[model samples]
Target: MSILESLELALKNIVSSKTRTVLTMLGIIIGVAAVIVIVGLGNGLEQYVTDSFSDMGTNTLTVTVMSRGSTRTLSVDEMYEIVDENSQYLDLCSPTVTMPGYVKIGSETITSTSVQGVSEDYFSISGDTVASGRGLQYSDMAARGKVCVIGAYLNLAYYGGNAVGQTLRVGGQSLTIVGVLAQTDEDLEEGGSDDCIYLPYTTASRLIGDVSSYIITMQSEDYIDESVAVLESALYEVFASDDYYTVTSMSEMLETMTSMINILVGVLAGIAAISLVVGGIGIMNIMLVSVTERTREIGIRKSLGAKERYIMQQFVIEAACTSALGGIIGILLGDGLSIAASTVVTRLMEETLTVAPTLSAVALAFGISVGIGILFGYLPAKKAAGLNPIDALHYD
Candidate 1:
């Protein structure tokens, strides 16, 4: 028989045993679906984390005291020490002392706001565009000015666009709204929107009553390794020891996170891989039953001069058909679940995440399913083909 004829007959036999065929296919369908969902979710989470860092600006580097340095003492002078030495490689740097307090303007008062003291470079350091008011300037810090920049969240919260150029008291110190940073951050987790409210470092230091301790933001233009090296070398020279300061870079953090997620995705998919094996086993069992039931058919075909190879080929095709159908269904369902999962994860993170089914992934799943069917089904089919035709025909 031709390959086409063998294929047509194989499918007919499968349909004739509809319940058994479907039950055998269940394992493949579940395995494929699980693999797709697990892998897609892993890839999506990596993308979400990377995008959140990108949203913070790829060139950005945040500086802070390390957790291990918790017992160590640091001063504002040390912040200047890191910058004064590293200033050549750095595009810009600014120090911040966060003080969360209430803001009051006339009859309006809003609490839970994160108040910060930064300088002229902080706005551009963060790519925050002024939608309504102006950001702090050199003279603002020099003259010990109380001028401030507010994010749109605070603008809409305590006052409307009406807050522009209006005076608000933070911690009982008066500040004039000079500029408003663009409200590009989409997070709504309580004070997440209130990412910053800029006052001159001088003003903030005095208001917070602690100029010595703070967060510093920096910008770097080179590769992550180079940037970290340059920043560390300069900071070490400034501190004369590693005991007092810590540095964290966006590229470094994002790269580490991406690698970790990839490994996790692989491990998760590997666990799901056991299901593929189980599905392949199901296919083999069903194929063996098919061969037994069709013993007479096999003998009649052999008597009619059909080759053993042809008979084996027919059973293999039946195995592949079951897997192919399951694979198609699984891809559809898995893609939908992955999209929803990524969406929810991104929302929880306050950042936009991209999750799309990749062509490589689709091809891999389909290819593997079909390959499993063939590999497992081949053994049973070979036994059926080598059957003693005379006995098959004479029996039952």
Candidate 2:
């Protein structure tokens, strides 16, 4: 029989056994939909993190001392020396020291307040603007000034009315609020930019003791390579080993994150693929039952001069159609679910997340389902084809 005739016969068989066909297709539907949703979410998370870091600017570099290495303390003087030596390549340098403490205003005390001791250049490097009053200045650090800058959350949470110039006891030290940072959508968690307090590094060091790291802001992206080289040389002289210090640029970090995201996506997709395997086994099992039920029909067709290849083709085509139909429906449902999930996440984060399904993912999912149909349908198709017509007819 021709391929068209086989397909027509297969369609008739499928229509006659609608309930069984639907049950067999269920597995394919679930498997394809799962693959699409998993891939969509993985890609969306990667894009979200990439955009977040990209917005922070590529010209910035952070220098940190490794925790395991030598315990030699790095000082404010050493930090300035490195900055001054590479002043031609660098625009600003800020040393930061963070401590866990509480901010007390009479009876109202916010516990575990994030207090960052930073230099005058911190504001410019951080890309945040002062909402009121003035940012820290050279004089403040030089004088070990008893002044502080509160984030947007702190200003609104406790000191909404005339926050600047108000005295708040921080870590048992009386410090005047010199500035209140502008409200920002970024940093939505505790210890984030919008929830922390800033003070001059000198004063913070005096109160909190010791600075751990420094953030170097480059003049432009053009100077990153040269500045990094100069900074690394300086740090090498101080620490004497690559293990003692780490100088990393934002661009490098972005690359690392991209690699990690790709690996994670691959791993997640692999896990979802397991369902497709199970779905294929279901198709095979159903096709075997189908072959047995139609055994007498097969015998009559063969006795009337039907070829084994034609008999096998009809069954194979029928199984493929069932799986392909399921795949199409799964793709549509998966796409809808992916969009809904993205919308919910975007609202909760107050930021846009791209979770749109890619063309490649749709094609891949559909293709896998169809491939499973062909592979699993073959064994039963062959089994029915190999049966002896006389024996099949006599089996009742």
Candidate 3:
């Protein structure tokens, strides 16, 4: 018989035995759905992390001095020298010093207010804009001026729009607010930019007593690795010990995070594969029972000159069709569930989480389902083909 004829015959048999077909397909359906959901969720999590890191910009690099007891620490001047020497790759650099202070407005006292002292390019490199008045200038750092820039939240909460030119006490010293930063989404959260006040790094060092770290914003993302290597060499020349200073780029860190996420997704997908194995076992079990139940039909076909290969082909195709159909339904259901899961996570996390089922994942799940049917159906099909016609005919 032609393959098409065998396929048609298999379809007819499945329709006639609807209950058995559904029971046999149950395992494949659940398995494919589970795999798709697991993989879809993994992809969504990876995307979320990527988006978060992207917000920080990949061209940014941070350098920190590690203090191991007697180990030498990098000075602010050394940090500048490093940037100045590598001016070809670096667009801007800043030494930062941060401390916590109190902001008092009459009887209202907002404690734990962050005070950061940085260079003039701090705002430009950090992607912040000055909303009103003006940002810190070279003169501010040169003279260690007592002027400060305040975040949007600080201005709105305490100064009530009259923040600029107002004197605010930080660490018992009065600082005139020179600028109010543009409102940023990050400002709404605790410890975000909106809750901080900025000062010139020189002035901030005097307040905080030390500047141990610096950030170099790269002019181009393409040279991040080369830039990091150059910076490392320069730091070695300055500090003379690798343990004293560490250099890292946001792009490199992001790449590592992406690799970890991909590994996690693969692991999760493997765990979900257990369900497919179980479904395959179920298919084998059902096919075996089906072979026994159809012994009479097998005998009649054999007596009418049907070949063993034809008998086997029909049964295998039937099993494959059952699994393939189930897999199709499972893909649809899995897509719906994955979308629903994304919605639930978004609501819980207060962030938009997108779950998109990839075509590769869908194809893999469906292909596995069909392949399982063929592999598991083989033994039962061979058994039916090998059965003696006389014995099968004699059996009730």
lDDT of 1 by residue, 166-192 (tens): 778888888888877677755433476
**Model 2: lowest-lDDT 10 consecutive positions:** 65-74
The sequence of per-residue lDDT tens digits that candidate 3 reaches over residues 9-122 is: 888987898887788787788888888988888788878888877777778898887654655666777777777888888878888887666766556667756888899989
Reference-based TM-score of each model: 0.86, 0.86, 0.92
Instruction: After the best TM-score superposition of candidate 3, give how far the Cα of residue 167 lies from its true spot, in angstroms.
Output: 3.9
Off by over 4 Å in 3: 66-73, 101-106, 111-114, 186-193
Residue 76 CA displacement from its true place in model 3, Å: 2.2
Model 2 pairs whose backbones collide: none
- Better structure of 1 and 2 per lDDT: 2
Residues 253-293 of candidate 2: C-alpha lDDT, one tens digit per residue: 88788888879888988887877788888889998998898
Whole-model lDDT values for every prediction = 0.75, 0.84, 0.84
